[model samples]
Target: MKTKLLLLSAISALMFVSSCSSDDDTITPSIPELEALELSNCSSGIAEGETLILENRNNGVDYIINCTYPVNGDLIIDPGVTIQFGTDATIRVYNSGSIQALGTAQNKVVFTGEDKVPGSWKGLYIISSDVKNKIEYATIEYAGAVGDDGAILLWSDTHLKMNNTNITNSQTYGLHANTNNNELILENNTITACKAPMYLDASYVSAISNGSYTGNNTDAIIVDRGFIDEDHTWTKLNVPYHFPNGVDVVAGGNLTVMPGVIMKFGQDSRLFINEGASGPKPSIIAVGTAAEPIVFTSIDNVMSAWRGIYFDSPNALNEIGFATIENASNPDQEGAIETWYGTVLNVHDVTFKDIQNCAIHQYKFPADPDTLTRSNLTYINVANAFCQN
Candidate 1:
C-alpha cells in the first residue's frame, strides 16, 4: 500500500511539471511600461496664431486635427498624425518662424482638402521664414488659389524637401515661388491639372537661383523673370502615362523654351502661340533629336486626329532640327516667315508633318526687323494641309 501511494504521488508531480511547461510556451510577456509612455488626445484643435507639436499616440489611434491656424512661430509636427481638412480650411505657416513636418514613407502624415478634388482649398502657405521642412508621401489636393498659382504659395527663404507628394487640380498654378535663392528639392512628385504646375518668380530679378524644382506635371511649368545670374536652365519633366496626352505651353511671359527637351502632345492636343498677348511673349527654341524626335499627336484615336500649333511672333528667328511641329497655321503675308514683332529664331534640321495650317509659315512682321534668319527646314516633309504664308 505504501509503494502504490508513493507511485501515485510521483505521477501527480510529473503531470504538474508538464502543465507548467505548456503554459510557459503559450503565454507572452506584457510590455506595460513601454506602452504607458504613449501620448493621448494631443491637442484636438489648434488656435490661430499659435505654435504646436503633433504626434500620433502609440495605441494606433490617429488624431483627426481639423483646424486652420495662423502660426506665430514654428509648428513642429511629428510623424503619424493624419490631419484631415474641413470646408474651406487652410493652415498658414506665417512669416514669424517656420514649419518642420517630417514624415516617413510607409507611415506618413497627410494634410489634404475636404473633397479630394484638384482645386479644393488653398494649400499650405509658407511666407517669409527660414524654413527647414520635409514632406514625404503626402497628398495635397483640391487646394488652389484664384488669381495666382493655386496649390502652393511660397515666399522668402524657405528650404523645402519634398518626396512622393502629389499636388493636383488647383485654380491658377500648382506651386508658386516668388522668393530669392529658396531651395526646393523635389523628387518623384506628381502635379496635375493646375494652370501652371510650377511657377517661379523673384524679387528684384534674383542673382543665383538655388532652387531644385523638378517633378511631373499635367500643365506647363511657368517661370517668371527670376533668372538673373544663375544659368536659367529648365527641364521637361514627364510622368508615366499609358496613352500620352500631355500639357501645352502658351507663354504668358517672356520665356525661352529650351532645346533637346521633350514637348509631347495629348491625343489631338496642340500648342498655340498667339500674336502679342499681355504678360510676356515666349521664345521656343525646340531642337529635338533624330532618333528620338519630339512627338505631337492626339490623345484619342491617334490615326486621324486634329489640333493646332500657331507661332504668331512679329519678329521670330526660330532655329529648328530633328523637331516636329504639327497642326500649325501660316501667317497672313507672303510665304517667307516675316513678322511685325521682331523675333529671334535659329532653326536647324527639323520636320513638319500632318499639320492643320502651314508646314513652314513666315509672314511679314509689323516690327522693325521683319524677317526670319538662321532657319533650316531643309529635310522637313509635311502631309495633310500646311500653309506657308
Candidate 2:
C-alpha cells in the first residue's frame, strides 16, 4: 500500500510541474502606452515637501505632475515608470528638491506636452537648488520660457547624471546649465530642434560621448564664461542644425579650450567672443591639425564670407598651430581707437577674416596706466587678418 501511495504522489507532482511550465511559456509581456497615468495613494498628487513614488509601468498612461505645492524633498522615480506629460505641464524640480528619474536603456520615461511647437510647454526647472539630480533614458521636448529659461533650465549648484535623454523642440535651449560650480555627467544624448542645443555656463563640468545636434536655430554648443574640465572629450557629435556654429565660446576669462574638435558654422553665422559682464580678459587656444582641419562652414549654402571666428575678448590669446578657420564676415578687429578699459587681443597662424572693428583696442582709463599698457593687439594673418594696439 505504501509503494502505491508514493507512486501516485510522484505522478501528481510531474503533472503540476508540466502545468506550471505551460503557463510560463504562454504568458506575454504587456505593451507600453503614452497616456496620463493616475497613481495610487502612495503614488498620487504630491503635497509640499512630500515624497510620492511613481509605481506604474504602463506607458499608455502618462503621469501627470500637477503638484500645486512646491517640492522640498527627494521624489524617487523607480525604474519602469513612464510619466507622460499632462497637457502643457512639466515636472518642475523646484526649490532644493530632486527628481531621481532612473530608467533603463530599453525603456525610457518620456515627458512631453500635447503641442509640439516652440512655446508649447515647460520642462524640468532646477531653480535655486542644492541637490543632486539623476535623469537617465528620458525624452523631454516642447519646452522653453521667455526670461532666462529653457527645456531643462538648471540654475544654482546641482549635480546631474543625464544619459540617453532626447531633448527636442525647445525654444531657447535644449539643455541650459547655468551656475558657478554645477557638475554634470551627460552621455549618449540626442538634442534636436532647439534654439541652442546645449548651453553650458559653469565651472568643473563634463559632457562626454554624445551623438548629434540637429535642426537648431542658433548655436549647437554655446560654452559661455566657465571652466570645462580637461578630461572631458566629444566624439561623433554632429551639428546638422542651422545654428551659428558648432560650438561658440563666448567671451569669458581664464578658459582652457582643448583639441579633437569638428565644427561647422551655418550660413552667415560666426563664432563670436563678445564682451563679458565683467572686464576680465578672454582667451581661446584653438589648435587643429593638418590631416583633420577643424572645419567651420555653413549647412545652408556656401557664402562669400561668414564669421568663421571672431574674438572680441579683452584677454591675451595663446593660439597654437593646427587650426583652420574659414568663411568669416570680418577679419580680426583692427585697433582703430580706444574706448573701454581692460581690452586686449592677440592672434597667430589661425587663418580667415573680414574684421569689422579694431583687432585690439583699449578703453583709456582716466587714472590707471596699466589699462593703457594691457590694452593692445597683435595679429598674424597667413590667409586671414590680424590686429594689435
Q: Please list the Cα RMSD from the true structure of every candidate, rounded to 1 decimal place.
A: 9.1, 8.5
Q: Output the number of the TM-score-best candidate.
A: 2
How does candidate 2 score on lDDT?
Answer: 0.55
How many residue pairs clash (N, CA or C atoms closer than 3 angstroms) in each of the candidate models, in the order given?
Answer: 44, 33
Model 1 Cα lDDT, one tens digit per residue, 1-389 = 99999999999999998877864476568754222122222343234455568665554434443445465455676766555555455666655656666666766666656576655566777763454566666656677746435567776776666667666666667677767757776676667666656665522211212223334344444434332222233343442111133222334433333443444334443344443465355544455677655544343423334343435554352344566654333322221222333445555555655444345454443445534554455423344222322
In order of appearance, the predictions have TM-scores of 0.54, 0.61
Candidates' C-alpha lDDT: 0.50, 0.55
Cα error of candidate 1 at position 277, Å: 19
In candidate 1, which residue ranges exceed 4 Å CA deviation? 1-51, 58-65, 113-121, 129-133, 141-149, 155-160, 168-183, 192-230, 239-285, 295-319, 329-345, 354-389
lDDT of 1: 0.50
Pick the lDDT winner: 2
Give Cα distance to truth, residue 287, candidate 1, Å. Answer: 2.9
Count of clashing pairs, candidate 2: 33
